[model samples]
Structures are given as C-alpha cells and as structure tokens.
Target: MQNRPDLPHSAINPQLVWTGFMAMCVGMFMAILDVQVVATSLPTIQSALDIDPDQMSWIQTAYLIAEVVAIPLTGFLTRFLTMRWLFVTSLTLFVIASAGCATSSSFGGLVSWRVLQGFSGGTLIPSVFSAVFILFPKERQAVATTVAGVLAVLAPTVGPIVGGWLTETYSWHWLFLINVLPGIAAALVALRSLPREDINTSELRNLDGLSLVLMAVSLASLELALKEAPTSGWISVYIVTLLCLSTASGCAFVWRSLHRTRPLVDLDNFRDRNFLTGSILSFVLGIGLFGSVYLMPVFLAFVRGHNALEIGMTMLVTGTAQLVTAPIAVALEKRVDARLLSAAGFTVFAIGIAMSGFQDPRSDYDAMFWPQVVRGAAIMFCLLPPTRLALGRLSPDKVPDASGLFNLMRNLGGAIGIALIDTIIYTRSEPIGRTLLARLQAGDTDAATFIGVPLQAIADHKGALDQKTMAMLDPLLQTAATVQALNEAWIVMAVLTGCAILCLPFARPVAPAE
Candidate 1:
C-alpha cells in the first residue's frame, strides 16, 4: 500500500516539536490549575464576597457545568477553527474571565465569570491532545503523552498548595490573577510555534447542530439534578423529572447520531471494546479522583480544624509524589501491558483510600504521607495506560472524537462522584450527628444538669444566656458531630475505591507492540 505523501513527515524539527509540546502543557496547566486553585481559595472567596454556603458551591458548579457542556463539542468545533485560532481564542477568554473573577465584587459575578472561563478552558484538553499527536510520530507519541500527562496531573495536585499560599498570604484574587501571565505566554507561543494544517470546510459544514444541542441539554440537566440531589432530598420529584429528561435527551442524541451521516459525535465509537472498557474505567476512576479530592480538604478543615494553608500543605505532599512518579510510569509503560499496569495502579489507589479511612481527628502529617505516596504512584499508573488503551487503536481521523468522548466521560464521572459523596455525607451525617448528640446528652450529666437557664428560655427566648457562653458550648458539640461525619465519609470513599479496583479485570490487555 502506498503511504500518503501529503501527510507531514515524522521527521519534523525536535525543537519545534518541544516548543509546541510545551505550549500545550502551558495551556493544560492553566486550565487545571484554575480549577484546583479555586478549591483551596473558596473559603477566602466566600468570606471576602460574603457568599452563603448554599450559593458558594455555584462557584465550582458553574465552571464544571460550562466545561462539561463544552467538552463534547470540541470534535465539531475543531473542524471549523484552526488549532492556533482555537488555542488563542480560548486562552484570551480564559485570561479575561480570570480578571473578571479576581475583580468581581459579588458572588454571582464571580460565578458568571467562571462560566466563561470554563467554556474557554473546556476546549484545551482536546486541543492539547490533537497538537501532541500531530507533532510526534507513532513511536514517540508515548513520550509526548507522558510529558503532557505530567503537566496534566501535576496542575491539579499543586493547585491547592499554590492557591492556599496565595489566599493566605496575598488574597484569593491572586489565584485567578496568576493565570493571566501564563495565558498570555501560551497564546503567544501557540501563535508562533504551532504549524499550519489543512482544514476541510466540507467537513466543518457536516456538523450536526441538533445533536450538539441535545448533548448539551442532556449533560447540563443531569449535572443540575446530581448537584441538587444531595441537599434537596435523595430522590425529589424535581430531580426525578430532570433525570428523566436528561435520559431522554441522551437517548435522542444517540438515536440522532446513528441516523445522521456526520453526527457531532459518531455513536459507533462505543462499539470498540477497548474504548468502551477504557471509558468505564475512566468513569470509575473519576469518581474516586474527584470524590477524594473534594472530601479530603473539607474533612481537614471542618473536622481537624486545619486552616486552608495546613490543608493545602497536606495535599501538596501527594501532588509532589505524583509528579515524581509520572515519568517512572511512562518508562514502565514501555515494557508492560497497559491493562496490567492500570490494574496495579487501581490497587495502589484503593490501598491509599483504605488507609485514609482509618484517620481520626488526631491523625498527624506522618499518618497521611504513606497513603498519599501510594495514591500518587497509583494515579500515574491509572491515568496514562488507560488513556493509551482507549485511544491507541483509533484511526487518526477519529482520534479527536475519541479524545473528546474520553474526557467528557471522565468529567461526568467526576460530577457524579462528587454528587454521590456529597449525598452520602449529608444523609449519613445527620443521623450520625443525632446519634452522637443523643449519646452525649445521655453520657454527660453536667451538660444535662445545667439546662442552660430553662429549656423553654434556651429554645424560644435565649437572649438571657450570655452569647459568649453559647458560643463556647456550640464549638464542643459541633466538633464531635463533624468528626463522626467525616469518618463516615472517609469510609464511603474507601469502599468506592475498592470497587474501582475490581474493574481491572474488565480492561482488555493492550496488544503487543509491533
């Protein structure tokens, strides 16, 4: 068979290749860091902006909802816009949004700006993957992915530490402002270094708009339902209605794609066993990943009475360990089947989660380190191989679509995981708190005897009791309940991680390298 001569030669300049790779890395770092940085800084933002707890979550939810909806459209959008144009536009939007976020005087304004940032940043992962694939040949693609992987993994891990420091020392605004410089640099480098490629307008015109709308609606509805389900009652009628609508919309999307000549996303890709299996694994991993990330800091802050900086420092260790192990995972990939490696990775992650389950309020930094080390190494193993296995067999033309779907599922999994953990914490915490309160009431005669100047007065007209006395008592009761709730949440996460380990057998072995 005659090979196509029109395709760019694999013998491109190494320096240019590195430059493009670094640009993609910079873009990814900006996107991911923005998300993680905000996690640690959320408290500061809440305090500065005087955000209610219920509304405070919108800061994260708005970004995720926008990002999720935008991700699936990457396949279609890339066909119309050149990579350079897309990267530059996205970076510009992200930078501007960051400025808006930093300067916003109200919580609503910050959330609105975050939505814009999410929309722009959503295009970044697919763009970076496409750029790396184009710059390197088949053999060296692993190396390229590894480099990108390191940045991708490290960004989220270090985001909290950086964000915490900035919020503690400077202000929460610095978290967003810090991205402006990197965003500008990435846009400039992308404009100068990325090679021009031929684009087919005919292909661009083939995009199915209806399917795009359906996908967006379905994902957005489902996310809204999940986010609210925790606090609004487990299966409220409103949630059920949204779930049904989301499901119907999703089905319609699949049905539409199957019939259309050039659907926004080809439904047939799911037929690939490896893709299907890898996607499932990715979803489960996402559950573990985001669930743990979200729960840990909250546990540290609310239960252990740690400040933002202390919590960030604890997480920083795991992030650093993951950074150190990323290259080693890549090297091992050369010699091992990705499936086996992934399974091993899941095992390590499960162990880490299990260890974390044992933590109490008194647990120190040393107690946290080993589990994080395991988790760091585990994530590198899980992230790289499954990604390779899922996309490796795809034809070059379908790679972009596959990447889009892959990332979308991962994000969806994260959303679901967060919802699940949040639900578990809420549902279980209350009952556990009540039980603890009852026990404390029964066990502490002194607490029971004081009565705090008559039960009726305390319950109805408590102005008589000193505010300082009430405040002091409130902390003791709250601390005990918080401890109980955190312990339950940790156990739930550990169990989920264990279930993820069982998914390894389902992953097909990577074919022997040629």
Candidate 2:
C-alpha cells in the first residue's frame, strides 16, 4: 500500500485510479447482485429443471458453501498475486462459470458451475475493500469508499428488480447470462488500468496445506449446518453432528495457524483493538442487513402475494436513503468521530427496524416507507466507519489478513442470522396458533378478527355455518400466526441492532480531521 516512487505513472495516476476503482465496483455489483438475483428466480429454475423442492435448495447451498470457503483464502492469495491479476482472474473465472450455468441442461451440471461461480465470486468482494486502502492514498480514499458503499448497499436492494425483470421478461437462464458482458468489460478494464505491485514470492512458497483443509472443512460444515438447522430442527442429530464437526475442525485450524511458521493467514491481526471492534460491528451489521432482506422479501411474496418486481420496488426506498446518505457520510467522516458516527447510525437503524416490528396484516408499501428510509440512510455511516476502523489503520502487511477476517465475520453472521430467524418463526407459529384458538374458544370478540371472522357474523351463523366457510378457518389461522411470527422476528432484530450501539464505545477513535 506504500507508494513506490519508481513505479510507472499509469499505475497511480488520478484517471487510472478512478477507472480501475469503477471497474471493481461493477464487478462487485455483479457478484453481489447474482446472489440475490438467483434467489428470486429459484422457483422458476426448479420448475424449468423439473427438480424437486428438496433438491432445489442445493442450487443455492452449493454456491454459498463454495463462496464462504473461498473468502478467507483471499488473504493468502494476495501474497503472490497483485490486485490486478486477482480482479482479472476472478472476473474471468466467474464469467466462464456464468456461461456454463446459463447453458446447463441438467441439475448436476448447473450445480457444478454454480460452485465454480461462487468461489470466483467470493474473491471479487474482499478485493474491493482491499483496493480502497491499497490503490488509493489516504487523502483520496474517503470518496473511493463512498462509492464502494453505494455499490454494497445498492446491489442487494436492486437485485430483485433486475432479476424479476430479466426472469419475467425473458427466462431464468438470463439471470446467469446477465453477468457475461459486465464481467468481461470489468476484467478488461481492471487488467489494463489497475496498478501492479511487487509480489512476495517467499510468502507464496510457505502456503500451509493443513490449515487450508481444516478451514475448508470447517466453513463448509458450518454453512451446511446453518442452512439445514431450521428444517432439521436445531437439536436433531443431523444438525448436531455437523455443528460438532465444524467446531472441531475450526479449533484445529486455529491451533495449527498459531503454531505454523508462516500460516495461510496471519492470525495475529485480531490483536488490533480497532479491527476487533470493527469485526464485531460487521458481524452485527450482517445480521441486520441479511436478516431484514430475507424477512421483507418473504413477507411481501408470501404474506402479501406480491411479485418479485413489486417487492423490489418497495425495497427501493431503502436504497434511495442510502444513496442520499453516502455523500453526507463521506463529508462527515473527515470531521466527526468514527465511533460516534457508527453509534448514531446503528441507533437510527434499530429504531427503524423496531418500527416495522409493529406492522399488521394490512400494512403495505405505504406503511413501509419511513422505516426503509431510516435503515437505508443509516447503512453508509454504519458501514464506512467500521470499515475504516477495521482495515484503515492496519499496517500494509496486515491489511489483507484483517480484511479477510473482517468480511468473513459478516458472512458468518448472515449465515447464522437467516437460520435463527427461520427457526424462531417455525417454533412460534404453532404456539401462537394455539393462543389464538384459546381466545376464540373463550368467545373473545377481538380474537375473532385473528381469523378475519366478524363477531356478528359468527353469532349470526352460530349453529349453521357452511362447510365452505369452515374450510377457510385453518388457512386464516395460519396466516394470522405467520404475521405474528414475522412481527416477533423484526422485534428481535431491532433489539440485536440496538445492542450494537453499545460496541461503539469500544472502537478506537478515528484520526481527527486534519
């Protein structure tokens, strides 16, 4: 990251830096968008392939497992490869894999390509964060990171809109195919415009085998356990066994990493207090970000019968809020305390989520506006400072390792957040149904509305209610219970996000405005 006065000007010139940075942003947007895009089209894909529901989940799972497993390895790869090659290779591999996925004729073929795409996609993400600190000088980085922040926030929210249009207007195959042109363009730009750095051939020579195996196994097992925990029941033998394997392998990896002469990743980066606080914040942010995204889309599509495009449109408010906030965040970071900015951000975000926790069955996009705006506007301040806290202050040698771990923690939190939210809804559904039933049986007039039944109508047909009307009773009850469950999930997330505010005090202060 240190400037090399002897290097060619094209590598560090203002124009090249901006182009290279924009290319990385395109690559990042494509990679993140692909994850959520495919999610929206899963049913169409399953139907097109004639695969069973059980087997269909694996389409997503395979990609996720591969992605998570490759994320931590980016640190090791950085030792031998410059940022340019890393960007070029990842985009190339991702493009080829996307083509394969688009043309896949069988279930197995698609899954194989997805795994490759996922690994390549994983490498694209951390590279952007690495680029922020490496390619640009500290004087110029705030604007660069603001741009990255916009991509990071916008891509996930806009994914459904893009995916729905492509899938509905065309075919599910178009989802993967969409990445090809952008991927090629990004790779070419990065290869041509990005500055190169001298590689550490000696560090490359000491790549540890045992640690890689353990990390791969641990992360893969952990991802599987999280994915399956809700369906299998957290206490079921299948989930328990996988968790145990993950823990053991993870412990073994840490042990070997600490003892190795040159570990794949430098484990000592966690010793930095700023990095530690940043990582914890990253983990919590993941829960808030992924958890809300998962919950909102499901609520819209399932409870309200909204299409993917409609859901995407509703999510736009959040993105717009984030877009407006990015510049303010950039301008403020130079003058404000990082910890205070982060605390204010999380506090506002938590309040937004908590507001949504009170939504009823009648709530729609109109009802969702303010909360979405609050959460959206808060993302910049929340993410920017923590990122600065985590990698901004690290020595050039430690930035890679710290970046890897920082991003990895966020992904892990997301994996765990989705599973926990699913589990809570399942466990609460039946109990909430029972409680509603008790109130109805006891003749509580208000309880009748839980099933959309009028107290007067029930009284009018007390003994002569038709069989057709009775059939709807179960469906109505289930709907009511689900709405209640979603409310509870939002509340829990709000509390979790609110608690993140407490971590702000632990963060090392940002350097004062010059």
Candidate 3:
C-alpha cells in the first residue's frame, strides 16, 4: 500500500473513508434537523400533549440547555471513547431518545427525552468537524469540509418545511420518528466504515469532577437565562441570579482548565490568531443564520397570517439558493485566499439581510425572495471559509478541542442573537404600537395606510371610531408594530454580520495546501 501526503496514512481506501464520513454527516444532519423540525411544530405538539402554554417552551428549552452543556465536552469524549465509538454511541442514543420523545404521553416525559436527545445530538457536530481535519490531508480538506458544512447549514434551512409538512400531512409524532430509520442506517454504516481504535478508559481517572459540575452548571444556567430574558426583564431577579451563577461557574471552569495539564476543554485555543478570528466570525454568522431563519417565519405567520406549512414553503427559497451556490463556493474556496472569500461572503450576506430590513408590514414571498437567495448563496461561503480559517492551521492533536470551541461560539451566538431579537420585538413593539395608535387617532392617513386600513375608512370615520371598530383595529395595530420591530431586529443582524468583516484584518491568511 502506498501512502500519499494528500490523504491520511490510515485512509487506505478513499471510498470507505468518504462513506464513513458521509454516514457521520447523516447523524449530524438529523441532530441539527431535529431542532428546527420540533421548533416549527411546537404549537401542534403543545395542543396534542395538552401542555400549558408557559411550560410548553420547555420542550425546546430543555433540549437547548442539555445540548449547550454537552457541546464543549465533545473533545474529551472523543479522546475517551475515540471518534468511531463516540459517534456510534451518540447516534445510537439519539435514536433511542427520539423514539422516547415520539412515544411520550406527558410533558415531563417528552422533556426528559428531549434532554437526552439534545446531549447526544450535541456531540455529533464537533465530532464531524474534527474529523474533517483529522481524516483528510490539507489539499482535500476544503471538499471534505464543504460536504459537512452544507449538511450542517442546510438542515436548519430545510427543517421548517420538513417539520411543517410532517406535522400537517401526518402527525407531530412523525417528527421524531423520521430520525429512527436514517439514524439506524447511519449508525450501522459509521460503525463498519470508520477505523477501529482502542478506547482509553484511563482518561476517566483524570477527569475533574468539580470542573465538570461547574461547566454543566455554567452552560445550563446561561442557556436558561437567555431563554427567559426576552420575555422576563433581563434585570428580573430570576434572570439576574441565573446570569450570576453562569458567570461565576464559567470563570471557575476556565481557570481550572488553564491550570491543568490536560483539561476537559481547552480554553487556550482562542489565543491562536486565526482560530480566534475564525471563532468570532462563526459566532456572528450564527446571529445572521439563525436570526434570519427565525425572523421570516415569525413575519409570515404572525403578520401575514400564514400557517406552518405556508411559512415553511415560503422559507424554502433560502435552502434552494444555498444548494445552487454550494459548488461555486467550494470551487472558489480551493483557489481564493480564505480571508478574502470570507470577506466577500460576509459582505453579500449582510446586504441580503439588510434587504429584508426594508420590508413593510405587507411583505410576503415576493418581497422576501431575493434576500433569501442572497443569504442562501452566501451561506456556503460563510461556513466553509471560516471553518478552514479556524481549524485549518491547527495540528491534528489540537483540532478536536479547537473544533469544539469554534463550534461552541456559533451556538452561543445563536442563543444570544435570538434573545436579542426577541427583546427587540417584545420591548419595542408596544411603544411603537402606542405611537402608531396615537397617529391613527389624530387622523394620520399614513398610519391607517401602514396597517392596511384604507385612508378613506379613516377619513369617513371622522376620528371617532366606535368601540367595536377600535377593537377590530387593535390587533391590526399590534401586528404592524411587530412588523416594524422585526425590521429593526433584521437591521441589527445585518450590522452584526457586517461588523464581523472588521475582524478579518486580525486573522492571518491561511497559505494554500502544497
């Protein structure tokens, strides 16, 4: 057998290598897809389970909290179990948890299964990213990363539509059930195709119990705080306590990690210039990616009165454009400097997001089409370049930990970005609504026109609408205000994404693989 510099020495058969990797990608896709699928169909799930509206959020929140707690631990898990078994073990559990979720008859049971699903699913993401660098040589890394990156980003794009159709055409139970067969096949293929390795059970002895506790407490608290902060005032006592606990525990964990010879998570990876810059870009990209996906559905459903399926179909343009542009992105990534490609991606992405910010209350599919296309085309560019920038320069031994930290930033960015978006929508909507109402009362024809109430109607009413008419107009006023507030949130995402480009100057260019 001959060894080539462009392939890992262990990769004697490229076909088997790719098959194994793609199998892992399937697990990653299902894991990421579950989040979006469950999210869009929450109302349906809530109705079926008879869950209290306030507590219904726990369905998603539990998963998020558990997932956040698990993401950084992936580096240690990989080292302990080895990549082959780590992936198989996680995916197997994810499958079991999905089945549990599908069969649960109560809220508590559903949430319990979700926690397990989230924890197991969380490990799949970093494991796949780490494999890109570990399994392939630099010359082939871009293509490998593109395959993983597309699935990672694509899952979220397609999730809403898949979820909507499933829940509408079949039932909410199918959401979790859909993962079962694919998960089983992926697990089987990954087990057979991935290289076998010895698991180091001895790594268990060196694990810091207290540090693990602190890390779990820190991430869990932070996720909880973010989830509640948008609705509950950020300074509310419960939210403040959660923030304080998260900060205290997080600092202690970091301190312990830096001082240890072999820590569970390597916080020092951020000190690398390219890795740090790449991580920042990943974080901001999360804001735009998750935030944009979130904003469109809210607008379509709340303001436009579209159902889950309709909203999903409307959002499909972004996914379509992403698929269309993926090859072009891969081709460019191999030839262009990563930093330059990243700059161009972010610039176009910001323009795309900014375009959505100008929509009036009546904005629908036609209004949103180009923006989705622009953002979609830019998604691969956003994902592939920053990925290479972050992990491309790191040594193989350091890559697993670095991948965890790099991917962690993006998830954190999403958690925080959504919270920020919600806060904007919640806090600003009322004030704007009040202002709009006052204008309408003062016979402002523009205010009437904005909410789709005819100018003639307002003029005919002579600034003295009956109570019944005012009641009917109230919901319209609120919807219009929310639309305005949503536009404001879109601009915030655009600005945040645009500002990500500023960090590019700090990242050293990754030289082409020889």
Candidate 4:
C-alpha cells in the first residue's frame, strides 16, 4: 500500500479532528441542501421567471453537469491543494455563487450562478471524507462517517421544508441567500481547524486535461440527450447527435484511462471486484435516491395540493428517520455480514418503493409516513454497510480513486434516473391526458362535471385555469394522473433495486477484525 505523503500526522488530534469533522459536516449540509432545496421552489422560479418547461430542467441540469465533471478531479486536485485550503476556497466559491443566485435578475443569470455553485459544491463530499479519514484514526472512521452520513441524509429531507418555508413565507431568492451565513461560518472553522499539508508536485503535473474535457463533454451531451428525448421525439436529430457525441467521448475516456500511465480516472480500479461491484451498486442506489427525490415533491405539490412548506414538512420524516437509523446501521455493519445486510436493505427499499406505488388520490399524510420511514431505514442499510465493505478491501493508495469512481457512479446514476423517470412521466401522461380529455368531451349526461364545468371546457382551459379554479379541481385530476405515473416509476425503481439484490450474493463477506 502506498502512503499519501501529503497527509500530515499532526492533524489527527482528537479535539481538532472533531472540530474539523463538524466543520466538514456544515459544508456537506449546505452542498446537499442546495442540490434539492430548489426543487420545492421550482414552481415559484417558473412563475416569476416565466421559464419554459424544456429549459426549466437546466436549473437542475446545470448543477448536475458541473458536479459530474468535478467529481473525477478530486483525486488530482487533492494532490495539489492542501485539504484545508481546498475546503476554504470551495466554501467561499459556494457562498459567493449562492449570493449571486439569490440576486440574479434573469433566468440565464440564475442558471449561470447555479453552475458556479455546482462547480464549487461538487468538491465537497469527497473532500469531507478525505479530511475525516486523514484527521481521525482508522477506528474512528465510523464515527466520522456517521456524522457525515447524518448530514447527507438530513439535507435532502430538510431541503424541501427549508426551501418551502422560504419560498412560501419570504421569496424564492432566500433559498440561495440562506446559504451565505452557514457557508461563511463553515469556511472560517475549516480554515482555523483543518491542518495544512504539502502538495505532491510530481502528481500535480499528471493532471489529465484532455480526459477532463472528454468527460465533461460526454456527461453534458448525455444530459442534454436525456432532457430532450421525451419532448423532442426519440428520433430527433439533436438527440441522436448528442447521444453519439456522448458515446464517442465516453469510449475515448475509457480507452485513454486504461492505456495511459497517468489516466484521469484510473480505469484499472474497476478490475477490483469489490470496487466494480460497489460502483454498480452505488449507481443503482443513486437511481433510487434521485428518483424518489424528484418524484416526491412533484407528487405532493401536484397531487395533494400542498404548499411548498407542507411538502417540506412531509419529507422531514425521511430525514429524521435516517438520522435515527444511521448509527444502528453502522453497528450492524460491525456485527453482521455486510453482504447480507445490504441485500436486506435493498429488499426493504424495494418493499417501500412498492408501497409507494399503492398511494391514491385519497391517501392521507399519515398513510405516507410509514413508507418514508421504511425508505429511510432501507437507505441506511443499503448505503452505509456496502460503502464500508467496498472501501474496506482497497489499499489506502487506491481509496481516493475508488471514492472518486464510486461517487461518479452515484452522480451519473442520479442523472440517468432523473432522465428516465422524467421521460416516463411525460410519455405516460400524454396518452392518459388525451384519454381523460376524450371522456370529458364526450358530453354524456352521466359524466361528472368538474367544478360544474363540462369536461371539454376544463380540458380546453388547462392553460387559462385560474388559481381559484385550479385549487378546486386540480387535486383530483393531479392525484389520479400522478398516482398512475408514480406507480409506474416506482415499479421500475423496484426492479432496479431487485437487480441490486441479485448482485448481493457476490458481495465478499469480511471476517471480524481481530
């Protein structure tokens, strides 16, 4: 195993390590929160900015694309920049970008700022993990992971609530502006507590610029293809061209990485069965994570007629549950076979997703609670143990590359999942909408009128429906349509989870450490 010369031993003081860990947690929270917080505020953004449906996705896409491009560079970047300096600089960039987002006067400006925010935010998770491992002893890695995990899980859960409250009570801008305070505080703490170390000038020169360009192009092109595939028609030339470009660049990335001495991604790591399996499982788990994240708020807002705040409060259950269960998951990983635990986690996740498929227009908030709790537990089971088991087998030298690759898979999976589910929803809703419209337009005497308006009138007035009228009848229609769409999506996710279950049989069982 190769030692990382850049890591200074003096940084491992218990109190300083604890302080730095807490600071990293703060940064991680802001990064993850910013990712999802905009979800609940999307409606507001759309309304205020008059963003087109096609372009609205770019709000999220901009962030995702930037993160995907930045993830693979973490290993190289750590070799040049000391972790303390990197942490402070990244946090500062994030804070400035957030402020820019809050103050942006146009949609284009907002998207631009979000891209900058994503660029800085992308370095956070890997950096946090690296800092924790470097600053704490091996035995305390679990505690560090727990702290980070809790923040990571809690961010998505609370994102909606926080974004909702800000969007509802104040304005959408506050969603971004709120980060400034925490960002500054985190940066200060990180700068003060995190130990500075020397850079590896030799490794610094090995940064693969061409590989980075190829990766960025590939991911960006793929994202565009996915976003446009549903609306642009699957056979559209733009989609085809983008897909081809993405495929070619992706192939080049792999070929170059494998054949080159100083490859950008170090493709050889995939030859490690543990790393390969872990990356695959991470990808699947990412589909579940991002898919549910995207689906839930859309469900609550469109189907249940809940305001953003209400939706946020509803999601709080999942976050709270994850916090409670994470420590237990770590304990279980220490005691039981991780392979079995991961399989059980996937099974539970599938069951929870399947339960989600059962929700109807009449389902109440209470009925939604247990499924979320189940998912929370499932996420802990799936994410924690598998992560431990996967990285546990790697030599320390390979850990950084393995971590980068693992995170990249998860991020890529998230992008693919969002694209798949969004496409499914768009495609499924059209025929259903058309059919429902036809029934409403039939003008049968027995047909139930919505808000005393004939079905035909309601369909025609979709674009012009007043808030008052929409408030009255939207829930029923949205509930029916959304439930069907979500059910189909969840079933697809369940199948993906099942694939993870099949892979679990191959997970190497580790004997307890003597």
| Candidate that would win on lDDT | 3
Q: Rank the candidates by lDDT, best first.
A: 3, 2, 4, 1
Query: lDDT by residue for model 4 over 199-283, one digit each (tens)?
Result: 5677657878898899889988987787778778668899999999999999999988888887876678788776677778888
User: Who wins the TM-score comparison?
Assistant: 3
Overall local distance difference test of candidate 1: 0.75
Instruction: Give the runs in model 3 whose Cα sits over 4 Å from its true position.
Output: 1-7, 461-469
Q: Estimate each model's TM-score.
A: 0.88, 0.95, 0.96, 0.88
Model 4: ten consecutive residues of lowest lDDT = 443-452
Q: What would the per-residue lDDT of candidate 2 be over residues 353-467, giving only the tens digit for each residue?
A: 8888876666789889999999998999888888888888887667767777888888898898899899989899899888876676566667686567778766766535467
| Deviation (Å) of 180 in candidate 1 | 1.2
RMSD of 2: 2.2
Clashing pairs in 4: 161-312
Q: Which stretches of candidate 1 lie over 4 Å from their true place?
A: 1-9, 47-53, 434-481, 501-508, 512-514
Question: Could you give candidate 3's per-residue lDDT for residues 398-502 as a string of tens digits?
Answer: 888888888889999999999999999999999999998889888998888888788887888888888988998988898889988999999999999999999
TM-score for predicted model 1 compared with the true structure: 0.88
- Candidate 4 Cα misplacement greater than 4 A, ranges: 1-11, 46-54, 430-479, 511-514
Better of 2 and 4 by lDDT: 2
